[model samples]
Target chain A: MADRSSKRRTLRLKTPISAEDIADFRLGDVVYLDGLIYTGREGVYKRVVDEGAELPVDPAQVGNVNFHCSPAAAVREDGSYNVGAVTATASFRFAKWLDRWFEISGCKVIIGKGGMTSEAYRKHLVPQGAVYLTTVGYGTGALLGRGIKRVVAAHWLEDLGIAQAMWVFEVENFGPFLVESDLQGNSLFERANAEVAKNLDALYEGLKPPVMSRYGETDDRKDELI
Target chain B: MISTQTLQNVAEELMAKAAIEIPDDYLAGVKGMAETEEGDLSAFVLRAMLENYEAAKEDRRAMCADTGVPRWFVKLGNEARIEGGPVALEAALRRATASATHEIPLRPNRVHPLWRTDHNNNVGLNAPEIDYSFEPEANWIDLTAVHKGGLFGTDYRMLFPGDGIDGIKRFLLDTLIAFGKRGLACQPAIVGIGLGGSKDTCMVLGKQAACLRTVGNRNPDPRIAALEMELKDLGNSIGMGAMGFVGSSMVIDCHIEAGFTHTGGMPMSVHAFCLSSRRATARVHADGGIDYRTDPKWFTPYMRRETVEWQTDPASGARSA
Candidate 1:
């Protein structure tokens, strides 16, 4: 009732994020996440869904946001997990099972690099009341340097390598993340794609004939043949 | 003669530099893109990237957590005598990688592709990928190491003969668009397009172009150079912006290298590196004097062998002839 459409909000959210909190977040809204967070990726998803292994930590109780990241985090000789140190990989590869990750992990929000698929948003995300957010790609060093405050816990050390283990993080001002997918079934990626495609014709028109014709026929000629 | 000690030291320092510092040219490219980029979203992301670079350098930490697999391109002088043979040079590089793992505290990224096994030291079978080219007249060794992350799409590619320049452009554009839409490739991306060679030749050229060439360096061949500039503009026009948000600074530059192809077919390869664009260079002379370089003279093979007499401006991050 608080002018849900136009009343924009910037939230600094903590863990055990409630349904009431996620409801305020719409597609394209940027949010800063703090408190408890955890990471997973293709391998972790496979392990959870395919192998039926229990996640070492439960986001439903402790953390409400999950990150689809496979960080290159190695422990030092002291054997302590390097807290707040991580590298974020691309998120699109894990698009297929993101909804399932949300279901199993009970995380209300997810963070990754690329935007999630429209199908995932439409079918699984909307019904389940979740969102997929995107952080800046290759901004790993910066994210850890400034955003992530500490590493709380890690699990599945022996079964999954350090890269694939479940890591719970305590973050401070964790993001200016773009909400690519939301409970409303809207996706920023799908919308941005359509917007970009509208300009493709204009872009193609600017391309001159290949500098020196080598193999293929000219575009003008090809049009006639077709 | 360049001793094994010199080789190992240079390699170790280069690896540390590759992880800790973003090269000057790459930094300039990012700043340039940020300056000209439109849209508040693009501006915000680019500013964050610039800040990130500064933080990494100041903190003496890797700019990115995913310090990718260690890769080295070595130009060995034929005349230069080594304490051991080529195998010694290779061993020095391997030792440097392992040492840098603890020294620079590089994330041990080497892992078994199938078994999901992590080699904590970032060394193993064919781990630190080294490509060697022997120069007959040279008396020194020049090595450049680049860290290729998992997110930067593909490091190597092959296209059929039917894919001419038009098809090649189409492939490059399509691939960038597809991956970039997913926020992969990490724009403003640096693309290396290698054309007209066997698969391996083109792949190597592509990798070199992406990891070696600086953003503003022109290809020696005028025609190829013109294409490189054209591709840079075209790629930026796609509106992928900093992190695939709508804006103007999608690509920092596109570097292309061409070699003579088989008459029957045309092969093309593309190597894309994310904005982190981490690389470092060092030279080991026969007299045991060593020098490290901020500007990697990878394109100018002849000049790399000769004594480099260049001045660098820190403010603009530019190199003068």
Candidate 2:
């Protein structure tokens, strides 16, 4: 048995767990992780790469990487955990710089919502042996439920707030999520979109309104509440 | 005495319960259509609807509470894989959502022809909403579970939850224009306008607007944020009630994304909101796996039921008391 109780794991880089190890993780499976990972999102990443300052992280300790947007924006002087829900947002603007994010953080798994586009998935993902995945959308509260504590990198807190906070946490489980994009460049975005278009076209062509609509002949619309 | 945590839990349990209780108003709309429409096509539509209702009833779920807004935007990662069936994603979504509606016994909000009726569950204009955005990630996919808020008109609320929001639309609209004007930081040019409902339908346009794919940020530049800030103030000034009558933040927080204006045209729209803001999310790994990524730091057990009970005062409701 893995003696699940006593293992102390720090937030590390995105570790390359084989398909065998990772496949076991389900949409709602909880797992304690042990590895090195860097933490950076929008503003956090900007400070590190843009400022060219001494890395707040101990390069030797970082194993993998984690990314989230709009994390806790305010710094609490008392050191009590500042709770928040996080999700990946608007990565299109940063695609050009994505490869660098991976290289710097050595992240194998980048978690975000909305499947990525084709070009970015292929060029940046496959060659690097990286993978991408999606979670249910707007599930903020349920998603935020997993945060256990704050393992602050000390100085990093001063530098980053919402976009750059380096707060590592112990997650309960990785959930009942599905893969939309893969190392081979397959994408859910393209597939889901095609289905939408097809459905829309069918709806437009098939349904027609009756000469006398059901809600009565009068068009007393303006006064109605929304 | 409901704390934020208690409120959240109540929001989840009772609201989810309400979702299951299919309202007569919605089902009535669907039933009314089944006997009237003519032709094989009508039959086809009727059959599809039957299946949807069946799934909802059997599973005790909602037909389509527009889970898409949360599912498409919240907990998603870079990739997603659906293996259960060859059924198209959209088709499966419709079926699943329909199942949810029927099971939850939620009111069917979909209606026909411009007059939106809560017949059965077929509200017009794709009553269910979904939004999307680009994302990046490792192998683990993310799934966002959301408890969305609903804004119904003040009237006909007893008839259906969808009806309560109608009474507040005027105040809401007035607030939107005020936000874009000199009163707020809103710059007329780069706005994404959302006009809900066809002047007549009981359908909710504002809630739909909130679910719409945004044109851009409510504030990209300082000018935009300033406009948003000003609007917030002015909107409250009108004294719109709790549902915008006595006045609250009429536009909520004008979230700004980035967008370009067409010449001098100031674009803006009214966005309605679901009340709960109930949603959840999780993530998948590189090999097509997931980590039900709940931020443990915030997950308190308070949401769960307790043995103790509290008393309520005569204040009935002191405005969110």
TM-score of 2: 0.38
Q: Where is the poorest 10-residue window by lDDT in model 1 chain A?
A: A1-10
lDDT of 2 by residue, A1-226 (tens): 1122123221222344454444333322223333333345655566656665555665445445354433322334575544333334434455666687667666666555444576888988767666554433222222332332344443465444333456554443332133445666766545433433343333224323222222222467644332
User: What lDDT tens digits, residue by residue, belong to model 1 across residues A144-207?
Assistant: 6467677687777667766777777778888767677877778887877776777767766644
Assess each model's interface with DockQ, reporting 2 decimals per model: 0.29, 0.01
Among the numbered candidates, top lDDT falls to 1
Candidate 1's C-alpha runs over 4 A off are: A1-10, A58-61, A95-100, A206-226, B155-165, B301-321
* Tens digits of per-residue lDDT for model 2, B1-321: 112222223223333433333333323433443444332222222333334444444544433333223222222233444344223433433444444433333333344446423334322356444333323332233333333432222111111123222222333343343332211211111112232223322223223223321222233236645655554444333332111111122333333222232342222234333222223333434443334321211111121112364223213232110
Chain A TM-score values for every predicted structure, listed in order: 0.80, 0.66
lDDT of 2: 0.36
Give the poorly placed runs of model 2, Cα more than 4 Å off: A1-38, A72-77, A147-155, A206-226, B1-321
Q: Give the lowest summed-lDDT range of ten residues in model 1 chain B.
A: B312-321
